[model samples]
Target: MKKYAFAASAATIALAVSGQAFAQESDAFSTALADGAVTELAPVTVTTPLRRPTTVLQSTSTVTVITEDDIEKSAAPDLPSLLKRYPGVNITTNGGQGATSSIVLRGASASQTLVLIDGMRVASATSGTAYISNIPLSSIARVEIVEGAHSAEWGADAIGGVVNIITKDGSTCENGASVCTTVETGVTYPWGGYGTVSTRGVSNSGVNFNIGLSLLGTEGYDFTTADNSVHEDGRDGFLQGAFNFALSKDFLWGRLYTSGLYVRSNPHFDSAPYADWMTGETVYGANEADQTNAAFKVGAEVDHSDTWSSVFELYSAFDYQKNFRDGHPEADTHYDTNRYGLSASTTKEIQAGAALNTFTLGAEAYRETVDSSVEYTETARDVAAVYGQYGLELDALTFNAGLRYDYDEQFGDAVTYNVGLGYELVEGLTARASFSTGFNAPTFNDLYWAYDGSYVGNPDLEAETSKNWEVGLNWAPTDTAAIDLVYYENRIDDMIAYVSDPVTYIGTMENIDKAKVSGVRATYSQMLFDDRLGLDFGFEYRLPKDETDDVYIANQNRLKLTAEASYAATEKLNLNAGIEYVGSRWTNADNIEYTNYAQYQLGAYTLVNLSAIYAIDETANVKFAVENLFDEEYQTAYGYKAPGTTVTLAYRRTF
Candidate 1:
C-alpha cells in the first residue's frame, strides 16, 4: 500500500508538470532557467529558508553565498579550509586531509548545525553529524549558509543554522547542445598526489546532466605527541575517492531533477594504548578505518496557477563506518545508518490592502535505521513534520513568521516558531531582527548504544532546546562596497553531555548542563581600482559559557579575525592572499581523570596563505598556492600539531 501511494504521488507530480506545460507560459520561469549564465554577484534564489524559492535579498535572516568563483580563487584543499574564511564560523581537525573535522557555527556544537546536499539531509543518524571532509570541492558549484535558528523550517539539528551545498549541473553550459569537461591534478609535500575529472552538458531540449570524480592520497604526519614527551607518534595515511551526478529537465510547468553523491575513504591512525596518555609505550599497531557516505534524490516542480507553485521530492541517504585493529577480526567494529524521506511544499502569493503576501506550507516524513555490531535498545525511528510560513511586504517594511510541529517515534512531539522583521532605513541601509526557537533530538548512539561497561547510553534523556535572538544592519553605501554588522544571543537548556556516574564511574549521556552563547560579527568588503582589486575583512567576538559551571566552553575560540585581498594583475593573471587568526581555547588536559577534570588553555595563532592563477587561455589555467606561508607552528587541540608550510601546484584544462 505504501509503495502504491508513493508511486501515485510521483505520477501525480509528473502529470502536473505535463499539464502546466500546456496551460500557459511564464517569462519569469524562462528567465530563471536562463540565469545559469548570469554573474555570481547577481541575486540568487534559495529554497532552504522557507522551503520555497526566494531571492537572497528577500530573506529576513542573515545569509552568505559562496560561489564557484570564490571556491576557485581560495585554492583550499577541503571544505573546512574554505569555510574558515567566513565570519561566525570555526573549524577544527584532528590531523591533515581526510581526518575527522568539526565545524562550530556561532558557538553552536558540531551536531547542532544541519547540513544538506541538494535539499536532502545527509548526516549520520547515529552520530548526528556530517563528514564534510569526504566531500570533494571539485563536485560543488555553490554553498548557501543561513546563520540562525531554523527549526521552524527544518525539524531538528537546526539550532545553529543550515549549510546547503548545490552541486554542478548541465544547465550551466551555454545554450544549444554543449558539452564541457574539466581535469585538474595537484601535489603538496607529504601528500602524494590528487586529481579530479568532471564533465557536464546540456541538450537542445533543455535536459542537463553532470558527473564528477576525485581521488586523493597522502602520507600524513603524526596527529598528536606524547603527553609529557617531545617525541611524536607514528605517521598516519589515508586514501579517499568521491563521485557525484546530477540531471535535470525543464518542462512547461517547471523543472525536474535528480542527483546523487558517493564518497569512500580509508584512513589509518595509531592504535589505542600507543596514542593514549601512557609512558614508556612505543607505538606498534595501526588501526584501519573505512567510511562511506551516499545520498540520492529525485524531485519535480510545477506551477499550478499564477499565484501558486509547488515542489515534491523523495530522497535516501546511507552512512557506514568500520574499524579494525592490526587486521584482527575479533577487534572489529562497524556502524551503518540509512534514511528514506519524502517531502512536498507549496507557495502562494496574494494581495491584501496594498501589501503583497507570500505563504508557504510544507510537510516531510522520514524513517531512519541504524545497524551496528554492538547491541542497541532501539534500531529505528520515524519522524514527521508540518510547517507553515507567511511573509508580508509593505513599502519599506517586511515581516515574516513561521511555525512547525514535529512528531517522532522516540520522543513524542516538539513545536518551534520564528518571527522576523526587516526595515529599510535608507536607500542603501537595512535593519533586521529575528527571534526563533530550536530543538535537537538525541542521536541513536547517545540514546541506545551499549558498547561496554565504561560507555553506556541513557534512553531517558530529554531533547535539547534553545531560544535565540539577533539584530543586524546591512549597508551597501556604494556599488563597490558593503558592510554587515550583527549581534546575537542564544540560551540553551537541557544541553546533552557525557557524564559519569559517581558510584560506578560509568559514562552515559545526560541532560545536566546549560549554555549561554553571545557574539558580535562584522564583515566589510569593497572593490577598488576599477574592480581590479578586492578587499574583504571579518571580525567575530564570542562569549560561549557553560552556565552550570560558570566556565568557558571547551574548544571554542573567543575571538577571530580574517582578511583577504585579491588583485587582477591582468586579464590572464590574478593574485589572492588571506590571513586568519584564531583565539585561545580551553579544554581538559589529556591525562586528567574522568572524576576530577582539570582545565588547560591553548594559545592563539595566525596563518597566512597566498595563491596565484595564470590563465593560459580561455580553456586552460595554472594555479600555485602556499599554505601556512610563514610556517608558524600551532595547535587547535592540546596535543595535535597543525600542518606546516606547504606548496601546491596544479593545472586545469577545460574542453
Candidate 2:
C-alpha cells in the first residue's frame, strides 16, 4: 500500500512538470485559475436539507457532490462504479458489468436509502430499491448525496440518506446550441467486449435531449466458485438504451420547466436458486431479465413578493420487470409498478432583530400501484404528508427546525422531526450538530405478497422508525484547502426482517426489536501546484449491528478508505488515479436455520484504477483507463467473485 501511494505521487509530480518551465507560465496559470479551470468549492443547491434549495456549507448535513467533470474524468463504466468511491457508500454486485447491484449508505440496508432522479423518487415498489445499474452516465449532469436520516424532509425510506441525481438540462448551455457524442469500448478479463454510444445536445432555446445505447456481453466466469458451486457456466450479457429530454422557458411572473426520462435494460443471469449455495448441481437453462423505467415531471416557480416564493410540481413514474428461462416465461412472473405525485411548497423570508429567518411549508401526495403476476392482498397504496421548516441565521450562529406528519393508507399515520445548530468556532472553522427522526414503510412485497411456501408476507408488520444524531466540523484553512469531519450514531426500532417458525420452518416478514449503527467520516481536499494538481482523501469507520441478538450485519464493511489525485499534465492532457480499501465483513450462509444462523467473514482488499485523457482539439477527446490494476480478488458477498483487471478506451466529441 505504501509503495502504491509513493508510485502514484511520483507519477503525478513527474508528469505534471516534466518539461514545462514553471516561471514561464505564471500568467497563463493565473488566467486558468480565474477561468474556472481549477477545481474549487462551488455553491450547491441541495433540496435534501429542508426540501428547499440551500448551500452545502449552510446546511447541517454531511454531503458529497459528483460533478460532470468528475464523472468524465473518472472513466467509470457505470453509475454504481462511479459512486463506490465516495465516502459512506458501499456497493455489492452479484457478478460482472450490468449485474444486479445493491448500494448501502452509511451501513444502512439497501432498501433504507432513498434515491431520486430530478426530484422524482424512482425505485421498485415491491423491493424498495433502485436499479442504479441501468442509469447511464451520459444522461446525468451531477449527483448530490446527503448522508443521514432525512425522513423529516422527505418522508419514507430515508433512514440511511438521500441520493439525488440531477440530469442534464438545456440550462447548461451557455450561448448557442451544442452537440456532444461519446463512444466507449471495453473488455473484461477472460471474457467478451462491451461497447456504448451516446449523443446529447442543447438548443439555444433551452431545450435539451439525450439518447444513449449500450451493449455488454461477456463469457463470464463462474461467480459462485467461491462456494464450490458449478451450477452456472454460461455467458452473461446485457443490452440497455436510455433517452432524456428537458425544456424550460422564462415568463414574466415565473419559470416553467419539464423533463422526461426512459430507460430499458435486458440482462442475462444464472438460473441457480440462492438456496442451493454449496450444491454443485446445475439448475435451469439460460435465463434473462427485462426491466424498464420511465418518468415525466413538470414544475413551475413563482415569486409572489420580495420575500416570498412558491413552487408546484407534478410527476409520474413507472417500473416494469420480467424474467425468462430457456426462451420460456418463468413462473409467468412479472412485476410492474406505477407512481404519481403532486407537491407544492413555499418559502418566506423575514428580517428579525439582528437576524434573518426563513420559513418553508410544503404538502405532497403520492400513490403507488403494483401489478404483479404473484398474488397480493393489496396492490395499491397512497401517502399524504405536510411538512414545515424554519431557519434562523445570526452573526455567527445558525439554527433549523422541521416537522412532518404523514398519513398512509395501510400504515395509519406517523410523525417525524429534526433540529440542528451550527456555530462559528473560529475564523475559518465551524461546528454543527443535528438530531433527526426517520421512518420506512414496509414494501408491497413485504406486507401483501401471498404465501410462497418458503416465505410469506405479514400485513401486520409495523413501519420501521429511527433516531439519529451527529456532530461535525468544517474547516477551510486556505482558499485551496478544505476538511470535513463528522461523528454520528443512529438507533432504529422495529426493523423489518425475515423470521422462521420453529415447528414448520416457514419464513415470514417480521419486525426486529432494534438495531444500532454508528460511524465517523472524514474528508480532505486540496489544490496544489498552481491549481494544476488536485488531491482528495476520505476515511470512514462504521459499526452497523443488529443489537437484538448481537449478530453481525451482512455485507457491511467496518472500515473504508479512498484516495484520489489528478493532474493537468499539459494543456491538452490529463491524468487521474484512485485507490479504495474495503475492510472485512460478515455474511450468512445459505439455507441456515434462523435460530442457528452461520456467518462467515470476507477479508479486506484494496483496488487501484488509473485513467488518462488527451484532448485532440476543442471538439474531440480520447480517454484510456485501467480498472483493478492490481487484479486483487475480493468479494462483497460470500459466494460471489468480484471483477478483475480490465481496460476501457473511449472517444468523445462536442460540436
Strongest candidate by lDDT = 1
Residue lDDT tens for model 1, 1-655: 0001111111111111101001001111111011123122224566776666665445677676676666776757778777776777778876677777777777888888888888778888888988887777887887777877899999898888888888877755422238878889988766667899988898677678899999988887776655523333578777889999999997778889999999899976655534434566444432668989888999998888889989899999988988776645666888899999999989999998889999999999999999998899899999999999998888888888999999998878889999988888887677888899998889998999885868888889878888999998877666555667889998888999988879999999999888899999877766566555667777889898889888778888899988877776766777888898988887651322355332267678999988888878767788898878998787776566677776788888877
Per-model lDDT: 0.75, 0.74
Write model 2 residue lDDT over 1-655, tens digit each, in one string.
0001111121121111211000000001111242344332234455666788775656777777676666777757678888887778889887666677878777778888888889889899999988888887767877778778899899998898888888876543222347666566656454565666655666567445565556655565555542434346656666777777777776668788888878888877666644435687534533677888888899999989878999999999888888767544433468999999999999999998989899999999999999998889999999999999999889888888999999999988889999988888886577889999998889999999898887788999888999999998877666555667889998889999888999999888898768788999887766677656777778899898888877667778889888888777776778888889999887762322355432367779998988888877655677788878888988776666777776777676554
Clashing pairs in 1: none
Error of 2 at 397 (Å): 1.6
- TM-scores of all models? 0.89, 0.88
Global lDDT for candidate 2?
0.74
Q: Candidate 1, 260: how far from true, in Å?
A: 0.7
Model 2 weakest 10-residue run by lDDT: 19-28
